[model samples]
Target chain A: MSRKLLLWLPFALVFVLFAVFWLGLKNPDDRIIASNMVGKPLPEFSARAAMPDRPGVTSADFTDGKPRLLNVFASWCVPCVREVPVLLRMQQQGVEIVGVAVHDSSPALATFLAQNGNPYDRIGLDEGGRAQIEFGSSGVPETFVVDGKGRIVHQHIGVVTEQDVPQLLGMLGKAQ
Target chain B: MRRLAALALLIAAPLPAQAQDYAEVALPDPAQEAQASRLMDTIRCVVCQGQPISGSNADLAGDMRRIVRERIAAGDTPDEVRAWLISKYGDWVSFKPQVKPATLPLWLIPLVALVLGIWLVSRRLRRHH
Candidate 1:
């Protein structure tokens, strides 16, 4: 091969490798499957009240006889805000929804709830994120559907949507 | 000319160490800083492409670090803060994509590439022999 061709070959190989690496990395699906805690007992943890409208609501307040949906959220989380309408609709449909505000301040969370309208039956504040860790969450806006026995029957990661609720409800057997 | 070239090489050699030294010296709140650093390992710096913010020396990564620190200091929980970042930047900001339709390719492409690579290599070897 000519000297110029030989010099270009290494550069070409490097470019191909770079392209492959870029494509592989840019594709967002390359991730480990997070642990499926669905159909398993929900981990127990206590948190302070977070409801802006009702400051008295605590973790103890969530233990009613009905099935409950525990949603981990934060004021700063955009997806959590996106899913607010869905959760609000669920609340209207009489779903027992509990909110866990992970790693957020009372002021910011209060403002968020005030602006968005709170959809939770009771809200819990996980100030230090200890409670979130206990629940095996890596991030916020994760929803857990707890059965009457407090076992987690379903877990949904990322933002919840109107479309997702029907499937979630089906999993919980709350659907007709 | 040799002495001048030697000086240039020395200057280039210490550039990375100097940069590292700056980072080490500028350490802020150790606890929050460590958490921010850990977050960098897990979070893909969007502007820097595939590299984790922790591993990248990109300007975007530094900006992300600043953002992470700001959220943490403002009392956003780690998960909440991460989620916030992901939301603002898209799930692409996360080194590990949350399972979703848009991100299915991220999980499958690597395996597909691996299988194709192995198949091609095996076919080439077989033909060679």
Candidate 2:
């Protein structure tokens, strides 16, 4: 190799390293821990009813020939409260939503629903958070779009804003 | 001064009692418990982001620790337990990356850098001599 080319190699290497780091840092999905359960069948588990009035959620509920949104939420999560109105709006559009109330009790969820207008068709109380973990959910307020066969078609982290409703609807439409 | 001390006690009293749910108990077999603890150190706490479950105080981490102990007590090898967690949380949950095609670059980059450094140093030294 030429002396001039060799001299420039170190600078080129530094520039390449900088570009790689910059691209990694700029990636929007960098902070999001992608779930391994997407495209897989829902893990078999049963959760008791979060509130007496609602039915308990089970894996069998999703296996029926009807796609639905499985919302993992908690009464204590502030973002879950923010997400309620959007979920209610989705429910208005005839989107069936099942819920896993992570580490929450009946009274707390009952109060939450009364305040925010219940959107869940069925709400299961995941008192130990085991069901949430089995679903590959890291935290509260994550939503999974499950198809008729019970495969997780999409996993959405964080509160679903008004802007996200159309995208979710699209995913749900495709899921069917 | 007495009122301030009373207020401090009230605040501090609940701190230790809060959210130490599943991790409070260890496996009955000391050998199994030791294996569980070792596995816990290698598993990242998803909620805490990079801290091991053994070091994290997060409720989820506590649950993970409990799962580890239970699995170990049931005769699961540490590798099997790690695989179970990785299956649920993805490879991100494991601090120790598995040797696979996707991770080849991660495993090789350091070796590549070392080789390049040695070649460069040897070239420079030879020229000086």
Candidate 3:
């Protein structure tokens, strides 16, 4: 009986390997890079305004006992256009948004906000995407729920659609 | 002929801009440049996912390369730079995984399999003889 089981060992190993591979295929972890910056205090950096009228953003801005959503976007990004209405709705609900414009020009961002409607209280220009890296953001259209203490509570990659609005709001509420 | 010339101009227009990106800029010191180049190969291009930062042409990768070169030029050791990147991007950014408790199996499995194979082969050979 023991000898017979030993004969089947290679087959068992192969089956186990195949199962792991199949599970990976079923639910791929390909695109989601878990940010190390989550639960950490926001990196110390200040950014200039991406528009003429809006004020610049800084790390000190978040510690004023208010939890806000920090949105990383660019005028050139298409999904940011789709995300504007959802953000505006959130803004209307009394949620303050802090925007970081990575690799964007002031004129382009001004144009984008003019067409889509500006929802940000302050818009920071992240030259050369340095601030995005500090925030552990890989691409544009990422949202972070920053707590009153300036710690990043949650990171939402990709476009924040209507479906994600409630969850983000809930996270923000609990961030205190 | 006019359309062909216009197409050619369009294709050539973006080349210089790409060539002037951070990845193309090298550190003044040869030793520092070589160190930065090696570090780039180990770092993942977060935007491209599969390719290393050195091999990727994505804008983010170019910025990362520039940061690496700048940090090296500013007197940071290669390990320090790697640690800094890991702090920002997590261990996923490095191709070489550290041998920790969770990754111990990944490090030891091949050696264990090799020993097992050799033992099984020797045992089978002895039995056949």
lDDT leader: 3
TM-score of each: 0.49, 0.81, 0.84
Please say which candidate is ahead in DockQ: 1 or 2.
2
What digit string (tens of lDDT, one per residue) describes model 1 on residues A1-176?
69679657757977999999899768754542232455556666678776546542343443454677889898988878899998998888878688888767788987898889888877778855555544555567888787766676666888998789888777556611
lDDT of 1 by residue, B1-129 (tens): 999979967866755554332222223457876776677688875445667877776544555565666666567777887786664445656766687788789789889878966986798799999
DockQ of 3: 0.53
Give the residue spans of candidate 1 off by over 4 A.
Answer: A1-33, A52-64, A174-176, B1-129
Best candidate (score: DockQ): 3
Model 2 chain B weakest lDDT span, ten residues long: B15-24
lDDT of 1 at A158: 86
- Model 3 chain A is weakest, by summed lDDT over 10 consecutive residues, at A27-36
- Clash count, one per candidate: 5, 0, 0
In candidate 2, residue A111 scores what lDDT? 90
Interface RMSD of 3: 1.4
Native interface contacts retained, candidate 1: 0.00
- Candidate 3 TM-score versus the reference: 0.84
* DockQ by candidate, in order: 0.05, 0.42, 0.53
